[model samples]
Target: MTVSGKTRHRFRCRYTSMPSPTSSLSSSYRNPGGSVSSSSLYHHASYLRRGKLVLGIMDFKWTLVFVITLLNLQPSSANGNGTVERKVHVGFIVDTQSWMGKIVDSCISMALSDLYLRNNHYRTKLVVHTRDFHGDPFLVLSQALSLLQSVELDALIVAESSGGVKILAGLGSRVKIPIISLFAAAPSLSFSQHPYWIRIGEDESSQAKGIATIVEEFRWRSVIFIYEDNDSAREFLPDLITSFEETDTRIALHIALLTSSTDGDIIDQLKKLMDLHTSVYVVHTSPILASRLFLNAKWLGMIGKEYAWITTSMITNFVNSMDPSVIEAMQGVVRFKPYVPSSKAVRRFEIRWSKNIDGNQNLQEIELNVCMVYGPMI
Candidate 1:
């Protein structure tokens, strides 16, 4: 029994807070024959060992024969017995050229269908809407809105960089549906005008709070924030610096306004910072920039127990994915924003998606973060 198509009403789950994708499943049933109580099964779903998804099996009985058949079938969206198709539509409007943009897009594309199918018990026809914020974001967003306004979408998931907030602001009153915003750092999001808009990514304020936590936890006496000269950086850094200042934290601020600077100059300025004996040096930039600094630190033999370096979570995962040698030097030295998945649900989703998607079994570092905010499978 799979529910297909968008219901006029959102099915607000009885249990709706964020769940650990890796949490242990607490219950299961043992019905010998075909029939089982739908009430019990629906309320307490059976998941695989480590919260991995059990694909194609909604709240229903599966005989041993059918189970084996499903297990043997090549995993994909279509295919497998006991699977009911439910198409979900989602749209992401964001800049695709940047590293973060590319990552967000890839994460959503790879994980959405498989995750939604397993978690929500429905197959999804994911429709992503994207736009680059390079030129006039207003124009790009307006175009996106025009396309989406008429489409009979299940749900609209919009993603935008910092610059795309105005677009979100403009669309707040015009579009009348559940809108989930990704990577949105709009000042207005805190208010009621955009009630439908829910932000899931680590905003600058959250990033700052995370930094302040690390600073206080480690008892790093003093800190210096090194940032690029850009509107986003400038806007966020001051608040971050202010948050750390509450403890009367010793802070030094340095600006690297590089419209076009050679790698040597970049490294040279970092080398000078290395000479400062700052307890912890923070870089509020993208992964590319963070990696450069990490590499420079490694080259200068500046990475060690003596100097603790930290940055926002945006760069931490990328740092971990770098070359082993590069990773080794900075291992345990960097930390990213932390959000644990429902261990029980995650294990269930993995198993389910694995069978559905034909055994593409590697699940480490896959992004289901979008799934967290935009509950729609698509």
Candidate 2:
């Protein structure tokens, strides 16, 4: 049958009303497993509603379908005029075995998808190639060099932990490609020194102020600082001490834990802290280390209302995505997280992501930040 949008057509046949056929049409469109095409189903339903079709409502629905089909058939603007769209290759250096690495991977995929879906007019598309560095500086440098030599990358997104930032930043400068970091928030990697590096994660120094505010608001006179023994954590310690000092707060103790620290080391450190009278603690470390500390603290019966545990945003941002048992261990802990404005788009994306992308995991703030930074650039 021919489909036309003639405005003044009428039919003499009567069979049924429009609602039943419209519902059937919708069902058929939703589940199109049957041999009948949507167009045929619509026409048959319209004919069944009335022995002969009328022009008004039926024609309008058909016109809408046709328009949607036409839109779907239209080629992308970037591919017009027989011109090939340039593919911008971007490399990602991450610790694939780690939790932050997974978040970074998911966020990068979502960002690229959103960019193309929203801006179909762009003349370039990003192609991401990922390399895992296992959070080792030497491995990170080797990976960066390999990626630069093997691929014509336009940019590099490094999602390593704190210690590897400088090595990756140096590689970015030597290669003359911008290095974008979504998770590395070391204060030492300054823009003046590493002009090619861009960090999107909230600076630990700024978040230290938030921590100090929480301490002052709670009227805590002194707190024990527990942080990773790395450049990133050390870089923020001075600022945190300064912030606390500004608010008339004192650091009762400072303990640095190495990544290679064993359970005995953690427990021993906790024993030392417990020997003191300090009940207030501020932890600034990677989630892995934070998890270990909290788990050991919970085992030692140190996590309770009497002891106030505060964590920096580095730990807070990914708290929701952490293992539930680990979250339970730090039940009453106060966390300092950067404020992010609520967006319906982000909410919808999160829901979709939880349902389809990673069913077991919730979207984290760092993942959202990564998407926000990379989405616009694409």
Candidate 3:
């Protein structure tokens, strides 16, 4: 099930939704607490559901906010010069409690810290003001307006596919300040029309082509598309579906599970999918939710030689930081890794990011947004 309005119509034009499977698997597995199942998968799913899957980022947010800035922010006055560094007031609106929000907050802070360290001669310093909109569109608009009026914000950063984007884009156009997205925005947010709106990440069309190519190579005739029910997933689906048509692949089923779905709810939906013969499933969700999904699927016998799984870059980018159990459950899954150009500077930034994480992750840095943040600074 997908969302409505123009997007829904566009998606439906290319999709043939598999016969509404078993009415949500009859939702019969719900427990007295609604989700506190005594099963092994439930334990893992619960941990992830609490937003603990991202590990260090959650615990380190406060430290990043308070301690990292102590890396010595520049005062309004430049060192030993009559000229002052222009403090560009930038506003960041996100749900800081969520997985994506935490990363954006930390990445921007680290990226800025790194920026000032090497380029000491830079004339402009970004002074960031963040507001947690708690995933509410109304809050996004309100917080955005507050930041604009209170701080005289020179620019705004928000999730490209967030519900708040349209609202903020309108505001940014009126104010004539840049509205930058944290990651690659989908096709819908055309940059041609709205010059102030900026998207940073892998090109959306290229991402779609990559996903379709993978599926085509694997010869998965009809696959199940499972994604988190969010603005990002909605924005991402149209291009992917179109790409599928070019590859002559059919979407047998597409299930949009809510970001807040509990273990029982998720398991019930997975059970419904089992009724279908389709053995391939494509998942597009955050690492936390996707981890939880895989754990439950493995426990339900969905992870095996008979089945194959593919994940979008959203989940793959952060898989290095996921728990061993979650990673174990994801064994043999295909992932679309976002490509970042290799250079000494990129390598240096990756090393610094690894150290800042207390060595919890040794893999290459996947914070495309970090590179994106550097754009405004230039």
List where candidate 1 sits over 4 angstroms from the true fold: 1-90, 95-155, 175-178, 193-196, 228-232, 256-261, 275-277, 348-378
* Tens-digit per-residue lDDT, 91-138, candidate 1: 556565654455455556556555555567434334555555543455
Which scores better on TM-score, 1 or 3?
Answer: 3
- Model 2 stretches with alpha carbons more than 4 Å out: 1-81, 321-324, 359-378
Each model's TM-score?
Answer: 0.60, 0.71, 0.71
RMSD of 1: 16.5
What residue runs in model 3 are displaced by over 4 Å at the alpha carbon?
1-81, 135-137, 359-378
Between 1 and 2, whose lDDT is larger? 2
Q: What TM value does model 2 have?
A: 0.71
Backbone collision count in every prediction? 38, 0, 0
Ranking by lDDT: 2, 3, 1
For all candidates in order, the CA lDDT equals 0.49, 0.63, 0.61
